[model samples]
Target chain A: MIDVQNITKRYGHHTAIDQVTFSVAKGEVLAFLGPNGAGKTTTMRILTCFMPATEGSARVAGFDCTEQPLEVKRQIGYLPETPPVYQELTVTEYLTFVGRLRGITGPKLSSALDQSIGRLELGSVRHRLIGNLSRGYRQRVGLAQALLHDPPVLILDEPTVGLDPKQIIEIRELIRSLAGSHSVILSTHILPEATAVCQRVVIINKGHIVAEDTPEQLSARLRQSEKVSITLKTCPPDCEMKLRAIPGILNVLPGQAGGSFLIECELGRDLRDEIARVAVLSQWGLLELRTVSMTLEDVFLRLTRHEDHLSEPAEATVSASAERTDA
Target chain B: MTPVQAVIAKELRGYFVSPIVYVVGAVFLLIFGLLSYLYVGFAGAQAIQLMQMQGGMAQINLNDLVFRNLFASMRIVLVIILPILTMRLFAEERKLRTFEFLMTSPIRITDIVVGKFVSVFLIYLGLVALTTLVPTVLMLFSDFDWNPIWTGYLGMVLLGALFLSVGVFASALTENQIVAAFVSFGMLLTIWLIAGLGNLFGDTTAGRIISYFSYMEHYDRLLRGLIDTSDLVYFGSGLALMLFLTHRVVESTRWK
Candidate 1:
């Protein structure tokens, strides 16, 4: 379990993380989504107790980060953006060192080391020096180090950043397998990765939480209007006129829908009710009727744009519009 | 073993597994050997010539010769060997970005600092051991006493430890290994040369402060087989001050 309460980090005059707050329950996977410089890594650093917040606090597994950093560190398995690996040491040696630093020892340490190696599929190159390993293998070793101590909370910052598609899939599967046993807060700007692995997503833009919900809920927010496509036996000459006369008809746009008229209107207006009324009154045969739904990608773009607009000052809008050019 | 011991063991293992440790050791031994051999030959010949000219038995005081050689040899060791021992201590960790992994662990800051210093110190100690041959040969062939040899080495260890501490502290000040090495060498040189300036100035209050602050002044007195309590206190306090500063620098950098 992790609770980050209004944690703010400031470096000189620049605010890196501004009053950011979120919570992840045990066994829950929370995806932190943001573009570059969105305070995602800053937030994860606070949650893992790697860096103290300038204001407010966070608790990992019931231990306050500022007050009991060692205890918080004990419960966290953090993989920083660059993996924080020692290039000179062998894979096994590096993991063993991390294990010992976390107070793992004797047979338990051996067991944890073997388990992490197997989980991350690092058995083949366990003894190879980390400097000699490929980038993907190095990333796996970094993940293996985080998993060595078997901490209850895992804070990974862009785990799949530069991995190939296959490595990304492997890492995604690895994170998915860790879901129910370890509470994870994975941060990445990659939408598909977050959608594929995280149960809940927190979208941040410019040091603020723009949106937080399940993938389904976030997609729902983008569905302000639903467009229903319909195929009739004939394209009626007065189709737009007839549809506009119906109640709850926000707008009626008629177009060739597979050789029939297409109807687009407000969501939940059930233009289906009004379209049925108009069609029956006019005696036009209906062939196909389907409502178009918004995808997660669409929701992401809309929310990020909306957040950008909301954060912009009114004076900048005019100058931005005047200087803007279309290519 | 205890946790601190476990950290120390792992640190030592790291030192041995990497080429940096062995390279530093080899270079230290090479320099120590060449400098001590040259100092012994030159000083032994000169002492024998002076004793012959004074109508003595041409059997120079080998103890005096060893004391002079130890002091001369240590001057070069502190400049070159001390930097190699400490350049990579904290800077390499930062360059590799492994400092975060190490600092964020459950181990206390003191443990990491102490463990790293102890490993470097052990390597220095091993290098010091190799130089024992010069004094051993003198005792075997000539009438050199072992007291000055032991005391000189004791002074060398203290001076080396003090220099290492300063290097360790300087290493913690930056993430660039070259910068740490050069800065440490400069700091050691300033302290090494300040006593000569003190004698040149002669008895001024500033001169007294400079003399009291000089690392070589205290070390030179100890190399004469006389362990003054004030000199002992100065070396011990200097070592403590540097180690404490190193710890503070390391702790502050943990967050950054």
Candidate 2:
């Protein structure tokens, strides 16, 4: 439903987004993962036709964003980072204005307003001025405004930034429910949000697409080295050397507690059994042994860090492995 | 409803909801009342003096003596107050970050500009209409040629429209409302001062051009009951130019 092709946005000499490209199929939820100033909002603005890209082109619902901006705008429901709301307008008034701007009128407009108010749970504050509402209510009103038109494509920039934890969960659930009917492109810096609510994750850094894959696939690809935590009743003097001597084991480090050790090994290698056998032979009581998997946060950090080290030619092999893991 | 109509309605609603409208309206009415009271007092005193000299009721032209001067003062009052009415039209949108919503919507840039201009013009019209009460009360107490009074009002409306357009253009140039008001005031004052420069040139081609650019010259003719098409064209084209410039500024903002 959306295709962004090699789009670059520059403010004078400063390039906000450079040669960025991505697409979202119908009903697919794509998370634009990036830190602050990673051009996420810039890309969203381009796709929503808020501003034209300095180079390349973007198409939404088969209409070019710059050439046929009205059509593209008609297809998109955008929630900007600051929630584009009038402080003096009540919730109903704001929604009605937005609906009219979208060419909705009469019974259709009122029904759409009611539906969105119900969906975003804004019915309670529908009569109150937006300036008087709390932050959470204001964010919901912003979401409701976006959904008022029922466009096939939704471009939300940082949709869950200011909500409390419970509100965050409710918003995530709301976004999840939008899948399979609306193609959603939501930008967020929060890693867990992407993993929990998105079907595909695109990690962006410094205006470049650093990595793109399913959340689980990204985690697995970055975890080329396995870690195993082992706790013992008593540590033998030679325990470290013994664990290091095992085949395929790369390194050993002390764990957080006393008499606990973390073992590292290459991928596809299981060092738990070997460590347990060695501990039994050395008369060191084994209390715990388990392999650790990489979290999405770890994967995001690895990808961004790898992007930062592009000048180092030797690390090409690690990136090559990441590409190989994509298969 | 069309986008332009929707924007106008919303903007009018916004104006009514805020206390700015009431305060500005009350202040304008108070200024009009004071000016009218003083004009009436002076006209009354002149009539008594003429009666004492001629030993009969003196024939005083209220429209010439009072309404003309009243409108001249009103022109200056509008110059000061109209900017306050228009400063928030675009500057507040920028400050509040609602410009994003406006530009991203399916509406055209012309709709946004025209809609904002019309809303403020209507508020100014309402203010001008309220001042009509002064003339209406004056009509009850004296007989004067109604042509000049009607013409004076027409001049005020045209001048108000032109000033409001400039105010909108100024607001579009900045995100600060106070700065918008000052810039608008400066622009209007410079145009008003152009008539002063016309005197220095004194009948030269350059003098005629400068005088033609003076809004006061066109407004003065209309106030004197000379309904020339040239003056109408001047105010009409001036309003169109300012609104067009405002539209360009708003459109360029998207590119930036």
Candidate 3:
């Protein structure tokens, strides 16, 4: 539903985004992962028809951003970084105004407002002034404003930046539930958010796409060390010390579960046999043991590091696989 | 509602909710009342003197003595107060970053510019309408010609509309409301002063053309109850020119 072909945006001597190219398919959620100043917002701005690129073209819902901006804007529900809300207006009033601006009126506009308010859980605060709401509520109001029109395309920039943990999880679930019908391209610096709600991750750094793949592939490709997670029935006093003393063991870290340990070892070593032997000989019953995968955090750090970063931008679309980050 | 009408309605609702319009409206009505009181007092005393000196019957023109001067003084107030009403229209949108929301929406630049212009113009028209209470209350006491007073109001409306268009244009030029107010104030003052420059040139054709450019000559004709086509054209063209300039400034945001 969206395609950007080699668009470059420049401001005088400074190039904001240099020859950037990406696309989001219908019913797919693409995570635009990058640190601050990685040109994420700039790219979204061009796609939303808010501004034109200095070179190349961006099309949304098959309408050219520059030439048919009205048509392009008609098909987008954009939640900018700031939420674009009026502090003085009530939630319903603001949404009504937005609905009218989008050409939704009468019964259709009210139904859309109810759906957005219900989905974002803005029912209680629908009549309250936005200025009286908290930061998280205000953020939800922003999200609700974007979803009010129910457009095919959703471009949200840092949608969960200011929400609490519970709100963040709820927002992620809401985004996850929007997987089949809406084509979403959300930009964020949070690594786990990408892995949690998005099927594909596109890591950008300093205006360049360093890596683009399914979260697991990017993690597996960047995985340089082997990690083993073991849960035991009873822990010994010198268990960590003994695990560190084992040859080729890179590091020892505490696991998430009770009486559990995460052991890192050299890439090619079979640490499972050695770990099970220690558990058997030391009379510690092994309850669970499994090799842990590298996280999106590791992939993010590995790709963003300039010393060995990809000079050529990663090409094509990424698909499949989902993993949770334990970090 | 259409997009333009939606913008106008939203903006008009916003004006009433905010404190700016209440303050500007109160100040406007107060000044109009006080000035009318002073003019009526002076005109009444002169009429009394003329009647007494001419055996209880004399011709004292209230149109010249009261209203023409009243509108002349009232327009200077419009130039000051109308900008305050319009200063925040575009400036606040830019400051609050809602300009992005508006620009990215499926509306044309003309919709925003015209919507904002009409919204503030309506409020200005309402304020100008309130001042009619002054004339209506005076009519309760004695009879006077309402023709010039009505024309004088027509003049006030056109003058306020012109000032508001300039304010909208100024608001588009910057993100600061105070700066917008003062920039428009400076522009309106310059246009008013251009009439003085016309005086310096006397009766030359250049003088007439330069003087015609100012709102003074056109508004004066209307004050005398003379509804000339040239004056209407002048106000219409001036209003359009300013709004067009506002449109250009708003449209230029995409390139930047």
Model 3: residues with Cα > 4 Å off, grouped in runs: A228-270, A278-292, A307-327
Ranking by lDDT: 2, 3, 1
Clashing residue pairs in candidate 1 (N, C-alpha, C atoms within 3 angstroms): none
In what order do the candidates fall by TM-score, top score first? 2, 3, 1
Model 3 over residues A93-129: C-alpha lDDT tens digits?
Answer: 9999999888999999999999999999999999999
Where does candidate 3 chain B have its weakest 10-residue lDDT segment? B54-63
lDDT of 1 by residue, A192-230 (tens): 888899999998878888889998888766555555666
| TM-score of decoy 3 | 0.90
Candidate 3 lDDT score relative to the true structure: 0.87
What's model 3's lDDT at B161? 86
Every model's TM-score: 0.86, 0.95, 0.90
Q: For candidate 3, write residues B143-221 as lDDT tens digits.
A: 7799988989988898888999999999999999999999999999999999999999999999999999999999999
Q: Alpha carbon lDDT of residue B51, candidate 3?
A: 83
Classify candidate 3 by CAPRI docking class: medium
Highest TM-score, which number? 2
